[model samples]
Target: MKDFITPDTGTQIGTLALQNPIMPASGTFSEDLADVFDLDVLGAHVLKTIMHGMRAGNPTPRVCDMPSGMMNAIGIPSKGIDDFRDRMLPYWAGYGAPLVVSISAHSMDEFVRLCEAVSLPGVAAIEANISCPNIEADGRAFAMRPDTTHTVIERLRGCTDLPLWAKLSPNTGEPAEVGRAAQDAGADALVVANTMLGMSIDVASRTPRLGNVMGGMSGPAIKPVALRMTYQCARACHIPVIGCGGISTLEDVLEFLIAGARAVQIGTATFQSPTIMARLVTQLRDWMAAQGVSSLGEIIGTLEIPQAADGVWA
Candidate 1:
């Protein structure tokens, strides 16, 4: 009979160590999930975006159904930082997993202020959602270009010593360029992307499906794009790239790791199966053991491209 060995699912994002690399994406995960399964069983806990002030979010029908996915323009509604620190922090403090707070802002100063406020006790790291428009930059997302990416990250970097994760926007044409800028400006890691911009329409009524007219698309449809961005940033930057978008299964997690993601965030898929993240954690371990893999790091960025006879990569 063959002896069994436990496979190591542990991974790190900069200096932060996690038991595994599977975490629920921001906005999708909440304390409610703790009732479905043990929250401490997961790799890390990522909260929804917290802003300087509370927002009501977009109008009705903020989320619209799409083929193999969904779209949302929730506008990052928040209950303000004070409420989160006073009410939510204590609830999460009891858990063993690291708590990562996601923050969004419209200007560099606001970004810095939010970082400082969220950098309180019990917080493990900060994820800056640069996908939001920068009021200082005429409504362009801070991650849309390299210069702005650097400036926003640099300012936020100074505001807090906690691990800073720059979440990039898929709307940008140059993901790699912006990723490099974030790393150079002292970002500890990168969340490869947010959802891609998309919209749906009602043919009969001649009305848009969402109240905001446009929303960010997520689910299996965006996997290819997220995978490509993860590869680009992982290749271009020194920081770890945490892949986000369309992840729902163990195979998806493996695909992200092979594309150079140190970790992955499961978003829209959670809406369908609340227990998905917890199941993946166990399945990932079993699969790795069966494949004779001993460590998660062994598979990170292990993709091999074919080469031509002339010594060029094909």
Candidate 2:
């Protein structure tokens, strides 16, 4: 029999060490998946975004299927922080993987409050879903600009000592700037990024498909855009960047790692194949062993680009 070496797939996001770099994106993962596979195989478990109060979320028909992906205006319907602490936290504690609580709020004060509340013992890290609307910014998302991103992250940092991962928005023109701001404000890592803003029309009804008229686009279609942002942010910030977008296969995961992302998050792909994340973990190990790569450090941030005619890489 041909001998194959066992590849080491461990990775770290700030001070929190992970067994592997494969983890589900916030809002796409839950405890129900435990039936499909062992959750401990994952690097981390990022729960859906929770708020201070319960939310009904967006109106019906909030999700629409696109050719290459899907759009959602879920409005972050949460059961509030109370239920998460009393119910959700314990259920997740049963799993060995590190728990990463995702939190969102409309104001800086609320964000700080939520951060403090979720900074419990079982939780390994906190992922700030700053892509949500900010009432203080005239309904604009806090991650839409650098200053707001800095303020929110800084406040969250002050409230907790747990690892802070700032999830950025892809809708902005300056992703690198926003990422740097989060880093400057003390974000331990960056989930680069959130879904892109998009809309679809129902040709038959002559009206918008989503009840909210528009929603965040995610899936294979946004992979290129997300990959670009990940590469940019990973280069711009000193902290690690966890790529999140349309990763469904080993090749996709490898591309993100080569682009400088320390890790990658699987979202819409999980809806299509619940067992995809686990399979990717196995696949990554097999691929690494076959390629004679013993560790992930050989793949992460290994992208090489030839110089342009003007002597600039870009």
Candidate 3:
């Protein structure tokens, strides 16, 4: 019998290295998914955002389906740090993939506290969900502005030695500036983007589709926005950028990598196909081999467009 070799999909974000580039976006991932397939299949386990105290989340109708995607205002309901540490930590620690815990807070003090607490031994990295409202800033998200993004990342960086991944929001108009601020503040990587803030209306019912009136839109519909941000941040910052949007197939994964994302996160698409991530892992390896690619790094940030006569991209 002969041994077969698989192409390498491993990538590094800061000092942390992942076996593959596929992971579930926060809020869409959980231990329950382990039942569908092995957790080791993922590059890393990115847990949902955890708060200092429990959150009840938004009102009813937190989720609504759109024509091409979906909107969610689930509000990041959490059982708080204590429950997560005592209950979920042990189970996650059993997995081979690294655990990247996502944390959210309304104040700088709370963010610092959560960052310090989650930096325990065995954790691989910390992903700060800066899209949450900053109570001190009158409810504006920290990632909405360059200054706020710097303040949040700088403070959190000081609290932990673990690799810091500043998860930015797609709702912002200046994602490049935000990415630069995060890098200057010591972020090892950027997860370029949370979700786009959007709303849907029902004509016959004459009311908003979501109970929150507005929610974060995600799926194939938002891939273009996410891809654009990934390209901008990847070029504007030195740190790695992890693209998250509507990735469902090998092509989507390759597109993000080509656009400069060192890694990609699969979200809503997973809800429709539980084993999609596992399938993607195999598909990526096969595609690379078929294309005579030895490593994913070879194809990353390699997009090409012809220049026009006026010196602009055609």
Candidate 2 clashes between residue pairs 3 or more apart in a chain or in different chains: none
Better of 1 and 2 by lDDT: 2
> Number of backbone collisions per candidate, in order?
0, 0, 0
Tens-digit lDDT track for model 3 on 15-59? 988999999899998777878998798899999999989889999
Tens-place lDDT per residue, model 2, 1-314, is 54678899999888988999999999999888989998889999989999999999998799999988999988999999889999999999998999999999999999999999999999999999999999999999999999999999999999999999999999988999999999999999999989999999988989998988989999999999999999999889889999999899899999999999999999999999999999999999989999989999999999987665464545
RMSD of each: 1.9, 1.7, 2.3
Error of 1 at 72 (Å): 0.4
Task: Give the candidate order by descending lDDT.
Answer: 2, 3, 1
Q: Cα deviation in Å at residue 244, candidate 3? A: 0.5
Any idea what lDDT model 3 has? 0.92
For candidate 2, report its TM-score.
0.97
lDDT accuracy of residue 198 in candidate 1: 93
> What lDDT would each prediction earn against the true structure?
0.92, 0.94, 0.92
Cα error of candidate 3 at position 114, Å: 0.9
Instruction: Please give the distance, in angstroms, between residue 8's alpha carbon in candidate 2 and its true position after superposition.
Output: 0.7
Question: What is candidate 1's TM-score against the reference?
Answer: 0.97
Candidate 2 local accuracy as lDDT?
0.94
By TM-score, the better pick of 1 and 3 is 1
